[model samples]
Target chain A: MDYIRVILTIFWKDILAERRTREILSAMLVFALVVILLFVFAFDLSPETRRNTAAGVIWVTLCFSGTIGLNRTLSVEKDRGGIDGLMLAPADRTALFFGKALTNWVYMLLTALFVVPIYSLFNNTNLFSFTLLGVIMLGTFGYIVTGTLLSSLSLQLRSREMLLPVLLFPVVIPLLLSAIRATSILLEGGSQTELNTWLVLLFSYDLIFLAISVMVFDKIIED
Target chain B: MRNSTKTSLMLIVVDILAASLILTALFMVFYYAPVEVEMGLVQKIFYFHVAAAWTGMLGFLVALAAGIGLLRSGNMKWDIAGVAGVEIGLVFISLSTIMGSIWARPIWNTWWTWDPRLSTALIMMLIYFAYLLLRNGVEEPGRRARFSAVYAIVGFVSVPLTFLSIRLFRTIHPVIIGSSDPAATGVFEMSTRMTHTFMISLVAFSVLFVALFWHRVRLGVKLALFEQRKMEDFTGED
Candidate 1:
């Protein structure tokens, strides 16, 4: 279908652009690493404490670094007048939203993939587990879905850099809380019953925001 | 001019009604409701605390409705109502949080705890604060309204999920009048007079919310009109 092609075209365009420059990914990765290092010194945890706090540290890092990627990606589009170009394309606006959100999700996942290994190395906790990965995927999906939508709005603002997180963090609390709980449980070998609720919460949040952002995308991007 | 006078008259009538009801509710809370035996006078904050919180929720619902209105109709009046609701809601939520904290110190032995309701309310406050900030950062009127309405709807949709996640994860806040939760800490029985006072206070606060919302909307209308007139004058000169 033309819609599918449109979405993929946008996705591939971002991939090609990133492959060329590596600007957004590099900034996100570096910022993520710095946050982890800062947390390491700030907490100064023992092995036992590290095991308990590792989930918190990873999420906090992702959240802060994720903001960098989101702000930069959207602002680039705005800066180059790429959004106007996309608008003039012969495609449904929702397809454009999907394309951007999918690319954003890939960026977030890639950041998490890089962060997890480095985090495990630093903390001596093997975070490369199936369960933790699942939570990270769901959390990152919800985060980027909402973040991409908000960043589009924020990019048009006078204080785009500061405005994104202010608009984002609070709305993303449920997703973050659920992710943290599930991650902590997996790390600590907690019972399955305890983890199930948080997983469900994450799924519900993803569904709700995904549907909302899709429906409202056309409205916000209207010239 | 006729419409303005009519609106002013209606506002005056609503103002008197809100004022008298609030005063009567205060009288009932202080005089009619029996002093809570265990928490003593500190428990009196409960009537106003709960009332302010109800008003806050009401204000948010107004914003939600106004958000939908704006999206459906593309009218600036809906945008005005949306902003007015959020501003008033912010004030009342702040009041409720402060008063709840004041009540919590004696009851919970801590200034604050991560009780599900308290935490969700805090997050709600932050979200709306960001809403106001988002509105402030935009320059163009139409674009600002469109962006803000979308954000308001998005933010409103997230609130229930936020509350649900917190409530399911951990809950120590009391369910005052409803479900029986053995784990809830602050549960207390209300006497008949206390119930009466609570109900009256809720009604009074709802009326106050309406009056304040209408006043705020009028202010927004006046602001928009002044800006429009100024722009017209400048354009005419050109």
Candidate 2:
């Protein structure tokens, strides 16, 4: 009960903060739109090629633009001294970790919400199937889980703005790989076993890293 | 303070062992190992190529273990061990990658393929490069050690998935010395001499890894001591 409250409190605070500014969400959305256009021009997508490349475009756009939001997730808190205040509060720190991850996860999901429809509109392909949306949710969870944890670590470093993606990208490659392949499978109506395997991969990835991040978040947050 | 005792007796022994073992392995690879009927001369590169990949994997494993050590014990020496492991791992992995690329040019008809193994190797290098950069970004020793250990653990978690993902994803890399995949290319059957040469090469590279790892750890110790002294210098007389 207490843990949930602390988490919700932070979540609410972040929501309020983001609502007031909407800076992170707007940046992510605009960047995602540009990436979609860039992909269309770069790949010279035909209807056939568009279906093949849509997964890559959607995932890459979310991956890159979400990075912009993730970089700010922690740095904004630290920059405003909110991190120190939260840490000093007599609340469970792991709860705070969850709250921040939850907020970022929501931001990424929202970004996908916008990007997926817009990508469909631009590419003139339907990408909003139930299974594809599920993949998006699973993939975004894994991505934000990692992005938030790593942003916490990177935020305290020198030249942190430039350092976040370098630190985060390698770690998330497997997730992206699975996500992209799974998206392709969904879009192309690939075999069930193939989809199951990538789903299992994404689920296991989310589980393992989530547990590891929770266990180690203490060490990272301790001043 | 510089290293005392001029040369450690153990280092001299390691140097001699590594040199002799590597030379013998090279001789075995070139002169002893029977050339495969199919890839001919280029097949010889397979020996050192495997050896270098083995050593590279060994280096990252050392870093991973050392990371666990640091997290559990909170010791600076563990950080030194971790740094030494990653630096050596990055260099040898790059070498292995180059060798693989060279082999691919002849065998696979391209200098590179978007194969899982190749991409994984490249990604591993990027992860460790980030590891080194992360360590360099922090001036405080404790924070640097803790953060890098965390990153190492996180980075290593992705490696096996590259292998696992390949099951659903097709690859053209040769399925050498393991379960046969008909889809694989560059297949070879190792004859008796090839087997012996391969074994010796593996052993020799293991020895070389140990020698280089130890040397790096020693240098790391000296650097830490030097840094400590420099820090002490900044404060006029405590």
Task: Using DockQ, give the best candidate's number.
Answer: 1
How does residue A154 of candidate 1 score in lDDT?
A: 90
Docking class of 1: high
Could you tell me which residue pairs clash in candidate 2? Answer: none
* Candidate 1 accuracy as lDDT: 0.87
Model 1 over residues B1-238: C-alpha lDDT tens digits? 9998998999999999999999999999889999988888888889999899878877787888898889889999999999998999889989988998998888888879887777788889999999999999987889889988998998886556434533454566666766535776666799999999999999999999989998999899999999889988999999
Best by lDDT: 1
In candidate 1, position A98 carries an lDDT of: 87
- Residue pair clashes in candidate 1: none
List residue ranges in candidate 2 displaced over 4 A: B1-7, B162-169
TM per candidate comes to: 0.97, 0.95
What would the DockQ be for model 1?
A: 0.86
Cα lDDT tens digits for candidate 2, A122-163: 766678988888999999998988888899898889888789
